[model samples]
Target: MIVITAPTGNIGRHLLPLLLEPVPDGETFRVVVRDPARLSDAVRDRVEVVTGSHGDPGTVDRAFEGADAVFWLVPPDSSLTPMDAYCGFTRPAAKALATHGVGHVVGLSALGRGTPVAGRAGLVTASLAMDDLIAETGVAYRAVACPSFFENVLEEADSIRENGVFTDSVAADRKAPLVAVADIAGVAAGLLLDRSWSGTADVPVLGPRDVSPNDLARIMTEQLGRPVRYEHQPTGEVFRTLVGHGLNEAFVQGIVDMKRAKDDGLDAGVTRTDETATPTSFEQWCTETLLPAVHG
Candidate 1:
């Protein structure tokens, strides 16, 4: 049996279909979710459902039972400190994996583990620490390390459509890798299905190439057939905006610190190679995903 957590989330939502398109014979799938209603009738009919927050010890205890491999993902929680949001949320699951004797685990994580700024990179630091916690379980683990997602641009679709502009806390020319959620899910699916690998490792899913905000604007302009532009927001403005939205102050600071670290090349540590590079490019994502969100 293979278990999936946060099955309704961005990466997990995409990951499920990839795993289900042609279910392996003699292999069963299970999902730990907050609401069974969120799953489609087709998916619900096929997989075992353990309803509750996966962060809860009771929920994980039930979810991990009789599981051979697990796909682990922690949903974003802006109400808590970064450590609590990542490490704390995962502590229960870590113990459950050991108790259940699950052999393999595929986890969602971020880039910047060994970088100079990793210690101060806030949320990324917490996420890497979470990887350590999982590795200690002695399960055959693969942390799908990734950079900022291309889907993040979807959050600013309105700004792009109405004002022809999108914003971020990076320099227009500073280049960094960005990946699609589907690609991240694809990597996780492969790991979950084939558990021959033993020790823990990071499978960095860098996109086709490093892209700057200016590059994003240029691509969006061409793809959307509209004059789109990039706006660089000051870190202070981002902090105030997020905090004003009633997010925890510490969480808000974590965002700011993460952005600062990214701008300083926190994600540049990994070299893009055939093994690490994913198929989707920022331009392709804009045409396929962002274009729809902006005009839909």
Candidate 2:
């Protein structure tokens, strides 16, 4: 059996189907979700949906019972401090997997994880810590260190529709690779199913290419048939704008710092393509995913 945590999330939603497609007849696939009722009927019918929180030791133990491999993802939201919440939640779950004798673990993490930055606010730092913690459990592990999500730009779609522009604190010329969430999930599903590699592995999911905000704007314009522009917000003004949108002070500061780091090329490193590298181009993602989500 293959157990999946956070199976209702963006990456997990895509991953479950991939994992199930190759299963031989009569095999069972299990999913751990906080609210099993929220899962779509199609998915609920195909997988064993177990209700539980990833942070609860008892819940994780029950979910991991009889499971051979697990796909784990940390929930990303505004409520929790990334470092404390991830460690507190994942530690017990990792222990459960260890105790249950699960064979493999696939963890979702981020790029720029191990690299130190002065004002990082510990988001990526916490992920690296989680990766290390999972490694200590002695299960075969693959950490999907993904770059920025192409879907992140969707958050600004409303503004783009109204203002004919996309805005960010990163310079218009700074280039960073952004992978689609679906690609991250695809790579993760492959790792969970293979069960061939041992020890800890860092799989960086670089999208098809690196593109700047200026390039993104051009792509959007060409695809949407509208003259969308790229605008660089002043660093001081960026924090105020984020605050106005109801972000907390700490998160707003973190966003500003992350943007500054990106502008300085902190996230510009490119890793050699791994076994799980089916790259999604920004244009391909925009046309097939982003545009439909925005217009439909």
Best by lDDT: 1
Candidate 2: residue 25 Cα off by (Å) = 5.0
Per-residue alpha-carbon lDDT of candidate 1 for residues 168-220, written as tens digits (9 for 90 to 100): 99999999999999999998998888888999899999988999999999999
In candidate 2, how many clashes are counted?
0
User: How would you encode candidate 2's per-residue C-alpha lDDT over 128-223 as one tens digit per residue?
Assistant: 778888889989888898767888888888877778777877878888787898888888877877778888888888787788889999999988
Candidate with best TM-score: 1
lDDT of each: 0.94, 0.78
TM-score for candidate 2, residues paired by index: 0.90
Q: Residue-pair clashes per candidate, as listed?
A: 0, 0
Candidate 1 C-alpha RMSD relative to the actual structure: 0.8
Q: After superposition, how far is residue 154 of candidate 1 from its true place, in Å?
A: 0.6
> Model 2, 26: alpha-carbon shift in Å?
6.6
